[model samples]
Target: MKHEFHWSQYLDTNHQKFLSDFKEFLSIPSISTLPEHKEDIRRAAHWLSNKLSTCGLENVEILETDGHPVVYADWVHANNAPTVLLYGHYDVQPVDPIDTWDTPPFEPALKNGYIYARGANDMKGNVLLLIHACESYLETTGKLPVNVKFLIEGEEELMSPSLPKWLEENRGRLTCDFIANADAGQTDKRFPTIVTAVKGALGVTIDVITGPSDLHSGLAGGIVHNALHIMSELISSFHDKDTKISITGFYDDVLEPTKEERELCAQVPFNHDENIKRMFGVRDLIHEDNYTPAEVTWFRPNLAVHGLWGGFQGSGFKTIIPCEAHAKLSIRLVANQDPSDIFDKLERHIHEHIPTGVKVTVSEFGVGAKAYTLSESHPALRAADEALKSEMKAAPVHVRMGAAIPILATFKAILGVDVVTMGFGNGGNIHAPNEHQNLAMCYLGARTYARFFELLGTDGPVDH
Candidate 1:
């Protein structure tokens, strides 16, 4: 506690400079999905590596991935202490629909106690906080209570394609007892939160072809099957009248929420109709009759068709039967479900339902991760609760999020460790335009992470 309080003093002395440095970090426009921003992504990685080295962490380096580079650093002087892997991402989602932003997405601006910029809250903000927390400890006491390592990757928005191989290759170097992910968000601005579970993701592409080329509808209407129609029919087959997934074996591995989990889920606040209007701008949500809206999103899997393309649209009617059609699907998986098995079942179902005149192909992409859940009694979570309560003066809430953090599962499968997903960012507007983070939460987060490092390193839980 003495060293932690000393670390807080370091944070206090450098508070303004930390804010200024973070704004500069947010201005790089490290959009991973865009090819033109490759340099920007590399710049962000270099910037992070430099900060880690300057922060007095040992072995700070930028390691190359097939795509973007990963920034690695650590302090392992605390022999026999638990090693905590701090995980985060520097890459941000593309700022599409550019006109929607109030300010330039890459130009960080401070207004009304918030920083408005791309990657400001989604992850980069927390990344900075974690780094500063480490810096605080090293600057004050010249060491940490626990061994700490940072694995800040640049391809998280792209589902972290290079991480699995990287993790396997560097398992010994990156070994840790548990991970602390700063990529999560709080339940509300007034209350901190710890994510107990995260749904996994599987991405697939569907392609259909009815002929070699397009043909005039007048000539092809009765003779040939339309690829668009075939694709539409195929998409329809994925769901039934009750909106449940129609694919066989889709729910075979799903773990039913325990009674305790159900109770915790029930305590999470909700206003179904208000959520539909505020978050989705929709009149209704589709689901089975037996479950609450929260259960449907958090405890169950849901599939969505992100894009559908086939015919022409050039402000004029082009009467042609398109020869090709395609759709991109993203499926969310809950605990105990395997992405590979679901993809295999889906591919088989698509092949079985192909029309007579059309051919269909299904391709699975990326090394997907399985869903994960941590026990309520996990020590890291208990440490997180204590840290959050100390920082916010309020107990944190526990919830399972619908979104997937692929690396959480990777840390578990490869390192045999659970991840404590403690959050300081807000939930809304992460990937959207005008994305921002509350500066006040940033301060609280720095204090908590600093305290958490101490708690994890101690022989037993540190008294609050």
Candidate 2:
């Protein structure tokens, strides 16, 4: 099979150009969830289409979906070579509460060796790293080692609603041997890591209505069923004193963490006290008898109340009893757990705890996705391990993310391919304010991707 020649020289020569291109890409505010920025999202897709075309990818086009357009590009160089599909999102989350930002979110300021922007860490940085890797091969050798495809979507933040439909419609063109997603976070700043598995998520909204309208608390508080109390009671049942989720049958499908996996988790350097203090401003860790905080996050199921709304909250305390209360709850599911089954059990559990005279309504906002794990023995995994070890000068660790990436399941189900989730960027204030990506990781990530492709090109399995 043909492979790219002199790829490293090209990367070294065009390093400055690559950084400039990334800055320009980050300048576009492709926030997909907001309707006002629809054109901006399309503009980002067009920009990526042009970049892919410049990198020598064939069949490049912006295919419009129900929501945002998907940029599809591929090169069918050799029929015998393995086809790798690359997936990432150009769209970013809405930079709300914009006043809190020290520097403008969309301005793309480089301060303290870090890029300060809304999508800097969450995705755009990683996207550019992958693009540069492809560019390196093309600039040096004129062709790729393997047939490659790029599927950069614009609706990942909004639950990726259009992705499934788009994938179904264009199933024929998306056939590939394996997928690689450069959209996840690294294990830490000191060590290079590959996230082989991602946990799933399920969201539900529960509402309780007790009376027709607000009533006088002094008179009705004693006799009437309180909607707030009922909602609280139902929410409280989803957890125990150990903080482990209590939804019936929630763990029935959960695949226990293997001994090797647990050992891998133990290898990750963690300071629970510092982590808690840095994250939640807490003094000590909480919950569970046998498990540590890291284990709870990576190996177990968790239920969290995302949002709760009910009574008044203006200036002073209101004496009136509210007629209704609502709460938005979400569950993070682990490996082997079925999201649909978990949602059903949660609904049933809520109904069993409903208080009389208060009508409880349960609406599932979204269902969770199952976690994913790649075989450690796979050749691609080994290649990834070698690439990271060479680049970082330390053996990379294998880790699992607590967060869910729904596309993992979609890729596995639709294309029948396991993805190599390797990227740089640590989880620090990811979705929250002050989100930032490490500047050093940016270079390391690019090097890793370049080396990964080089390794795969030279020694990757030829059977597939």
Candidate 3:
């Protein structure tokens, strides 16, 4: 079977136009986490619908969900070729601390070969890449080799709360042999990487109330319990000195990593501890005992306290005992661990750990997902490997991801399909100010997608 193709040169010829189009796509601040960008989200969905239609896809339409919209498009003409469902998102993380940016977050700025924008790296650039790749194939040869369908969504940054119901209602329309989860990218351009697994997730807010209102610190200092103090104790109960989650039954459902999985994890080129410490601005690294950060990253689960607040004031101390305290908590689970089960365990733990005077409530806020692992022999992965090898001139490495992706799990469980997530992202500074994408990687990803479509179609892998 032929792996390399010259048609990717189309991306080179139209690089300038691609850049302009990508900039226009990035200009819309479709921040899903905020309510004010509702219209912007709709605008992004419409823009994608038009772009998908012009890319030679048929029956393109804007799909509505309870929260945000999902853009659907497809071209399913290849009779024997496999139908590959492509996945991406138009929603982006909110650009906070807006002053630190060298350029406006919504304004695409090309500097030093990188495009600085809010959604440029996190995924709008990726969405544009495959669309143009499809365009290249259709405009050059008039048809695609394999059937293609797009499920670009607008609430990925919000953890896709409404995606479950939407997927359930539209399951028939989304039928396909495999999925191309374009939500992730390779860490290095030198050697492409394939993510084999991603941790599952559960998010909940902890609300602790000690009384109806605040009390004077002088009056309640020793006589009454402080809400922040009680909250701190509750949080402290969740972890031990070993930096392991101390919640009961937390590890009961965790799937132990196989020997081969551990060996492969060790071989990956990564400095887990040093890199993590640097990224988090911590002097030291701490994780589960008898395991390095790399081993624990993909193999073990993690419970983290993301936010905590009880009492505060302008400049000086408030000198009052705050009656209420709140905390945002997120837990990442490995394969075989269910988020709902974990939430039940967390609630039980909280009930057992709380003090007498404190009233605690655990409200599940974000979308929860089960852990996902795609088999290495899956045809979608094989096609991605072939495409990457053709473009990078080297074989790709497979690694497991620590982050949570709700769509991968949802599609796998509900639709009974596997997803291969491939990309050309360098993978840093996303979800923060000054997020950027390498312009070269952007076009390279487009070319890679072009090659992937050809390889999948011609080889007839994952055929129905």
TM-score top scorer: 3
What TM-scores do the predictions have? Answer: 0.92, 0.91, 0.95
Q: Tens digit of lDDT per residue, candidate 2, span 1-464?
A: 22445777666666678767777887898998789999999889999889888877789999989889999998767445567788888998877678888877777777777777778888888888888887777776777777778898998776677888788888899988788888887756567788887877777888889889989899998788777877877778878877877877887887777787667777687534475466666677775667767777778888889788887879988888888999987787887888888888988888889876778888865335666777776668877888888888888888778777877887777777788898776545566666677777787788788888767777744332
For each candidate, what is the lDDT?
Answer: 0.85, 0.78, 0.86
lDDT of 3 by residue, 45-153 (tens): 9999988887678999998899899999999898888999999999999888899888999988888898899998889989999899998877767789999999999
On lDDT, the stronger of 1 and 2 is 1
Show where candidate 1 strays beyond 4 Å.
Answer: 1-5, 270-283, 459-464
Clash count, candidate 2:
2
Q: For model 1, what is the C-alpha lDDT against the true structure?
A: 0.85
Clashes of each: 0, 2, 0
- The C-alpha local distance difference test score for the whole of candidate 3 amounts to 0.86
lDDT of 2: 0.78
Residue 23 in candidate 1, Cα distance off native in Å: 1.9
Higher-ranked by lDDT: 1 or 3: 3
Displacement of the residue 171 alpha carbon in candidate 1, Å: 1.4
For model 3, state the Cα shift of residue 326 in Å. 0.8
Residue 339 in model 1: lDDT: 90
What order do candidates take by lDDT, descending? 3, 1, 2
